[model samples]
Each structure stands twice: as structure tokens, then as C-alpha cells.
Target: MTAQEAEDFLRTYRSMLKTWTMAVAGFSNDDSDLLYRQLEADQNVLADIAISYPEKSYSVDLLINSRSRTWAGYAEQRLPRPQNRQS
Candidate 1:
């Protein structure tokens, strides 16, 4: 997406930040990755937006990216299987 389109995304995303966040939390690993890939694909535009909104820069895709990364981190973390007991 172009920088302008990215701007539009940010505007809309801000309005839905809370809902998007909840949705992200419930997303499966694959789904989370899909969203992350979509966002990361426009990293350049996001970075540009960062420059434009320095005050709340973190509110840009960085916020979502961080959450996506958190999802990935949790996805990689799993409890170990129980060992079999001796007879």
C-alpha cells in the first residue's frame, strides 16, 4: 500500500484499536502470523507514519507489530509433555 493508503489505515485502525486488540488475542498462530505479515508488508509506510506522528508514534503499526510478536512468542511456548511413570 502507498503511504497515503497507510495513513488511511492508521486513521481507521486507531478507531478500532480496542476491538482489533481483542481479535488479535483470540487469533490462532497462523492467523496471527497472517495479520503480522500483512502489517509487516507495509513496514516502510508504517515507518513513515512513525515519523509523521512522533508523539504517538508507538500507536502506529508498532503497537500492533509488538502484539503480534507477543502472540508469536506465546505460540512458541508450550508446556512439556508428562513423562511416563515406571511400573
Candidate 2:
């Protein structure tokens, strides 16, 4: 995908997120499915753009990538398995 397309996709995602968030006021299966599909589609665009050097701009994809790394670290540590106790 070109840079313009990537930017447009992020804008569409933000618009969809805002509409669902404001309209529903909470999570819904429909919104979840929409978000998952959007993310999956955007992932390919992101991967394609990764090979090219960025053009000195702060994009939503870049921020989201950083945030995902941070979230992954915290999430992995948060869900530890419980140890079995001796009878």
C-alpha cells in the first residue's frame, strides 16, 4: 500500500472506532468483529510500508506499534499461571 492509502486506512479506523465508541458506549460483538477485520487488513499495509524509510512524520501506525509492544510486555506478565499445591 502507498503512504496515502495507509493514512486513509488509519483515518477510517479512527472514524469507525469513534462512531462505535460513542454510539454503543461499551464493547459489542459487532464492533469487535469490525475492529478485528480492520486491524487484520491494516497489518498487511503496515508490513509493506515497513521496508521503506519513514518520511519524518508521526503516524498512528507508528504510535500503535510502540503501544502494542508495551502492552504485550505488560500483558504477558499479568497472566501468570498458578502453581499446584501439594495435598
Candidate 3:
């Protein structure tokens, strides 16, 4: 992914994570808020990395996949892939 694509994926994923974190009726706000804050901070840090080294897509991808397999699954479907050289 390019820097712009990484940022876009982060934006979209953040929205989904926020909804998933907050939409449960039984979960306390404290828990939800804490989770959201932590994830948001991670997103910010990753965004910074993408911005600082736009060519380092693999680095950002590695961090994200390490952080959340659920996210990585979605990302595999959503993020652009390198075209096969022979194709």
C-alpha cells in the first residue's frame, strides 16, 4: 500500500473499530473509552510512520498485522496488492 492508501485504510478501520468498541450495551463506558483511546493512539502512531516514510509500506503493514488479525483479514481484502510480474 501507498502512504495515502494506508491512511485511508486506517480511517475506515478506525470508524469500524469505534463502532465495535462502543456499540455493546453491556460494556461500561470506561472500558470502551480506554480501548478506543488505545487503538486511536496506535492509529496516530502508524499514520505518523506512514507519513514519515511513505515508501515503508511493509513496515506499517507488519505493525498493523501484528496488532490485529481481524484487521489484517479485512485489510487483505481491502488493501491493494502488488500485481504479479508475469501477469
Candidate 4:
């Protein structure tokens, strides 16, 4: 993928993550689980983007890693407590 394409994908996934997170906050248990799964899938897509674009991997890696930390923190605060969380 070109750098522009990588960036576009990153932006899309980041938006999806944020939207799903908000939806999860008000969803039923089953719905929340589904949204969480989608969020994880989006994360995988971000990883894939990094791997698929070696030419832009450095910037992509940095963007993905930074957003990951932010996502984790936001999810922790916004989502319900997990039954099987690991430290």
C-alpha cells in the first residue's frame, strides 16, 4: 500500500474503533461482546496494514503503536470490567 493508502486505512480503523467503543458503552451484553470483537478485528487490520507496507512501516508502526496505547486506555475506562482480564 502507498503511504497515503496506509494513512487512510489507519484513519478509518481508528474511527471505527472509537465508534464501536461508544456503541459498546450502551449495548446489551451480547451486543457489547460483538462490538468488542469487531474492535479487535479492526486492530488486526491495523497490524496488517503495517506489515503490508514495508516502505511506510516505520511511520505506520509508530502510528499504530501510539493509537494502541490510547485505545487500550480508553477501552479500559469506558468498557465494563472483564471477567478474564490478564495483567
Report every candidate's CA lDDT: 0.55, 0.50, 0.56, 0.60
Error of 1 at 67 (Å): 3.3
- Cα lDDT for residue 61, model 4? 68
* Shift of residue 83 alpha carbon in model 2, Å: 42
Please report how far candidate 3 places residue 5 from its true position, in Å. 23
lDDT of 2: 0.50
Q: Model 3 segments beyond 4 Å from truth? A: 1-40, 71-87
Error of 2 at 47 (Å): 2.4
Model with the higher lDDT, candidate 1 or 2: 1
| Residue-wise C-alpha lDDT for candidate 4, range 1-87, written one tens digit per residue | 666777888777666555555654433333545655666666666667767876656755665564446434433366576778664
Clashing pairs in 4: none
Candidate number of the best lDDT: 4
Question: In model 4, what is the error at residue 38, expressed in angstroms?
Answer: 3.8
- Superposed on all Cα atoms, the candidates' RMSDs to the truth, in angstroms, are 8.8, 10.6, 15.2, 8.6
| Model 2 agreement with the true structure over 1-87: per-residue lDDT tens digits | 666776676677566655444333332334544654666566655555544526513555553453244222222234543567342
Q: What TM-score does structure 2 among the candidates reach?
A: 0.41
Best by TM-score: 4
Off by over 4 Å in 4: 27-35, 52-87
Q: List candidate 2 segments past 4 Å from native.
A: 17-30, 56-63, 66-87
For model 3, where is the 10-residue window of minimal lDDT? Answer: 21-30
lDDT for model 1, on a 0 to 1 scale?
Answer: 0.55
TM-score per candidate, chains pooled = 0.42, 0.41, 0.32, 0.45
